[model samples]
Target: MESPKRTRNGADVTNAAMLVDHHCHLDFPQFAEDLDGIIGRAKAAGVGTMVTISTRIRQFDRIRVIAETYKDVYCSVGTHPHNADEELDIPVEDIIRLAQHPKCVAIGEAGLDYYYQHSSAQGQAEGFRRHIRAARETGLPLEIHARDADEDTATILADEHAQGAFPAVLHCFTGGRDLAMRAVDLGLYVSFSGVVSFKKSEALRALAAELPLDRILVETDAPYLAPVPYRGKTNEPAYVVHTAAAVAEARGITLTELAAATTENFFRLYTKAQPPEELDPSLLKGAPPQ
Candidate 1:
């Protein structure tokens, strides 16, 4: 009984559904040469917004500048687990202060990364807790990065939630079903990246299909993990469409439905990032015409 959804230009909802690449590092040097083109391509590909996540608190100004340079770009504040030791001294108060910037929308890409152990486990744990406190204080979502440390990550998340609930998403999730469900149980979201589109990622795709639509999100984690067809090439926000398509196929839904659900999820978690005024709000509110 619902009317077909259309964009301002009257394009079919199938082609006009907007997407938000909620996580990526626009400040990375890989994007230095073609930054303008990158943003242009992303917009052209229907990526309505992007969040250039911060991996180090010290470099937040540079990350913030990227978000400021483009109207559709936003940024997050916090240290990545790999650099946790280096920024171990950074207090929760400092993170809270940095997050006060209007352009700052989330509190972290922080959590556990036992894969590389670039930072000591203790330091990573300490830093993770700090970012959580900042997220709780600022009422902003935390972008968690958990790699090969799912158990610890879930334990920290559960322990932290017991202290106080904070909005968060497990970004670039390549974890087991248990971790995925644990995050969902905590009222957090799980974001899929290009990794989900790989040939050997059947388990990941299955997990993506299993997650509740409202608690799922999609991101590029760009200049890294480029999706299939462009697997060996540098990833960008534009390629998030491929990732979304993979997720949609996994979930037995259309790309428009996936885009609407994930975009809504992004806005729900990153409450500070405003959608573009020109976007048709109706597209986000209901199922598009079948």
Candidate 2:
């Protein structure tokens, strides 16, 4: 029922070619003044679906409001590593309870971020473990944010995964190939962000090229890393197309094929998110054909 959209090159991308910005922060103030315009731009670029990641569990209502307001916008629930201390007392039950909402499709933007130890390593580890437990219990994918803590992140993911299987993804992945491979070996997915589009990211691009196509996804991680050309500007979900284009080139595939694979991979992992058929018909318009 949805028509196709056009890429920057004017290629007609059907409903099936719709891209998903699997991770972003629409709740952040960077786009507060133009949130509607931002979402519209993303849709225009064929990023028909997006997930606004939660950074603090206590502020989930703000995140929830955004998701509830936008038909195609879904969210994950759990504190990010930087704010893990604030939510250290929140139990896994609460995370799982809040995630019961139809719009809450994943467990976290949680994991270790030694790059900026806003929270103690111990606290982050504890919070990360709790989130893993929540993911295991709820059957939602854990959206991990590991930075400069690959070994610890991998260890915890493997340790918990061994105890009981859970779906997970290493989001905005800029880690070494070893960590990427480790995540894949454990059946977790790796999502690239605008960073991969940087001209100096050849090493990162190499890792991306080495990944199994099905194991890859892309994001804007907006209000953060904007892809090339828009690299220094305020990032938005709309710019995810550039990141996807860069990745598609790295993988030696067309944007349409990469879009289909990543979108399918998104739905497969975030099972709580509705399939395109169940999405608002309006959002599906201009999407590539199935």
Candidate 3:
């Protein structure tokens, strides 16, 4: 955990063994009053950097503020599949345009979500396509959020990548082995979250172990998906160490090695990230109403 400290704007860390949460959502109200404390714990826990991903393009300006204010945090642009209908008119050009912001480093937390189907399938698919185009046009990595729609997710990704390749990471992966290979085949990275730390996730841990080291990333997907010790409780970025520990165990490496490798993977993909400012107390939005 003790490494060279760096900002989010692509500064080299003195400690190559530092860990990074390639994806997190500190903007959610769940962390409200404690956002500063949450981030403090994360930094103290050795999480050197984090990407505070976005779910609604309309809320992106606020997302930018979080990234700009925090020295170790960056943000993304795009609508989540659940919010697809709310932002149906958001075009690929708009996404690409907004992504030009210095702190907007990735294209999405967008993809199919058949499990919930919160938005119509067509809307989700359309949004996914728009984000794919944005990712390609901006040359920013895509952060995908597929869940229980493996076939459609696989199909769309294959179709779009056929036209032109784009960097992408399958965030919070929870599908079968076939989908994993398909994602890998298209040269997209796979990010493991707390789900990989679950008791029945031996299958997922096996997948994590088998994947090429270069193509893997670790994430908290925080405010949700807390790993083993904290499962079913509210999660924040600091607990990324537990999930990182799970990933390291799956890969048969020490937490130190996992920290080093994933930190490298994060910077490689989030190339636009440099050192950020000091951590922002207002990173999350309003606290959720109880």
On lDDT, the leading prediction is 1
Candidate 2 residue lDDT tens string, 84-190 = 99999898999999999999999898999999899999999999999999999999999999999989988998899889989899999988888999999989999
RMSD of 3: 8.6
For candidate 1, the TM-score is: 0.93
Q: On residues 155-257, what C-alpha lDDT tens digit does candidate 3 reach at each position? A: 9999999999998999988888888889999998898988888999999999999998778888889989987777898877776777777777788876666
Which is the winner by TM-score between candidate 1 and candidate 2?
A: 1
Once fitted onto the true fold, the runs of candidate 2 whose alpha carbons sit more than 4 angstroms away are 1-16, 277-290
Model 2 backbone overlap count: 6
RMSD after Cα superposition, model 1: 5.9
Clash number for candidate 1: 0
Candidate 1 global lDDT: 0.88
Flag regions of model 1 displaced more than 4 Å: 1-16, 286-290
Off by over 4 Å in 3: 1-16, 275-290
Give the lowest summed-lDDT range of ten residues in model 3. Answer: 281-290
Q: Would you estimate the TM-scores of all the predictions?
A: 0.93, 0.91, 0.88
